[model samples]
Target: MSSSPKNAMLAEHRNIPYVAAGVTNPLQEFDLYVPERRNTLDTRPPPLICFVHGGAWRSEDKAEHAGLARRLAAHTNFPVAVSNYRLTTASTPIRHPAHAEDLLAFLHFLLTWSGPHTSTPTPPYDPTRLYLIGHSCSAHMLTSIFLQPLDPASDSASRSPTPSRSPSPPPSPVPTPDSLIPSPALLAATRAVIMSEGIYDIDGLLVTYPAYKTWFIAPTFGRLRSYAPWNTASYRSRPGAEHLNWLILHSKGIPW
Candidate 1:
């Protein structure tokens, strides 16, 4: 007897390392969900849905969101990838750009991945057609990847390195110049971004919700002397930024 639609099976690949295993951090991994095809004759590759989770940028894992990924894959008949990234911790503090860097690495991996399945003859999803969905802080992370620096002068000034009296350990290496800057190919391939309750205006958020400062802002981004560097609302638009479609969702009750 044929299986019921409610009980349909999905092909799930778990803990697939996007970065070089053991060489880099272990959090740079993702879970992929592929729905079983009902039409045998349709051979066209489907678009990829890359989901970025939200947990104040300090909690949650890809494994925790497998159900969402499976549902997305099954509903849309498209492959879905739920990704993990380095999170801020008390013991080993992680800050801005680290989380976004890990995400960019995953994107690079997906763009160049060669389907090397030993058992199945099925091809991989089309990398050129990517639909990104990010929630909460994830919205900030995704924007950090695609948006240009808000102020080139200030950005360069900040990197000039001010003199300090007290000796301190070197700041964790910032992402390379090209790492945060999305390439033309990447921008072209990204079809759309859907941001839900996104934290775009950092300063605005802090002005309204003072509790966020203690909850996640300080922990994830350090003391906020100025929120300009972390704010996505003021980011400059590049050449390719206009081409991609964007959908921003916010609750009517909450001011976003």
Candidate 2:
């Protein structure tokens, strides 16, 4: 007995949240949109597409993307998920890797079908078919986290240097891979990746656009006392990336 129906199943699962590092804030949540219709003969869980929205690393909310998620599911007849992550600002400073770790946590929760944030049972997903779709800052975050291999022993939050005068330590690191971390196997099965208007070279941007350093980079990356740079070069040779067929989208108006 499977939850995913090959035939047209008109259903849209919404506001399905997932836990990340014990944070109960609504920002550590996600909304899932599943196609209302499917190919009847194909008795398989539809492909899964996870979306991470972009807000220049600190401004937008996931709720804003609800229409996009619904459209993606309806048009493609696939399971589409949009997630939220902690944003960084002078007052609420969240640094490098925390955003990505939350995404990783969401993926694990999706694969396992149970997490502290999720209140209802999730539908079955196709383990063999997955896709990651991210925009702008989220594209960068996804690139950073997924480009590196999972070190079961390492904690991204702890590895991040705390701000010199911040009041709270960063949120806890995402769960260590037990028998559940899904990337290795899921990545192998990824059908495609769609990155829209992504920032590929961080250092280059800093060097070329001096104003951006103080305006955007400083608040996002500079907040961290220490961090290893992950750039386009690092993304090219990432593990499991070799198999992915990528569609990189960019606006012609922006000259980067």
Per-model root-mean-square deviation over C-alphas: 4.8, 6.9
Query: Candidate 1 lDDT, tens digit per residue, 167-248?
Result: 4333332322456778778888999999999897766888888898768876766554446556676666667878888899
Clash counts for all predictions = 0, 4
**Judged by lDDT against the true structure, how good is candidate 2?**
0.64
Report the lDDT of model 2 for residue 206.
54
Best by TM-score: 1
Q: Which ten residues in a row have the lowest lDDT in candidate 1?
A: 168-177
Off by over 4 Å in 1: 1-8, 24-26, 119-123, 154-178
Candidate 2 ranges beyond 4 A from true positions: 1-10, 20-23, 114-124, 149-182, 223-228
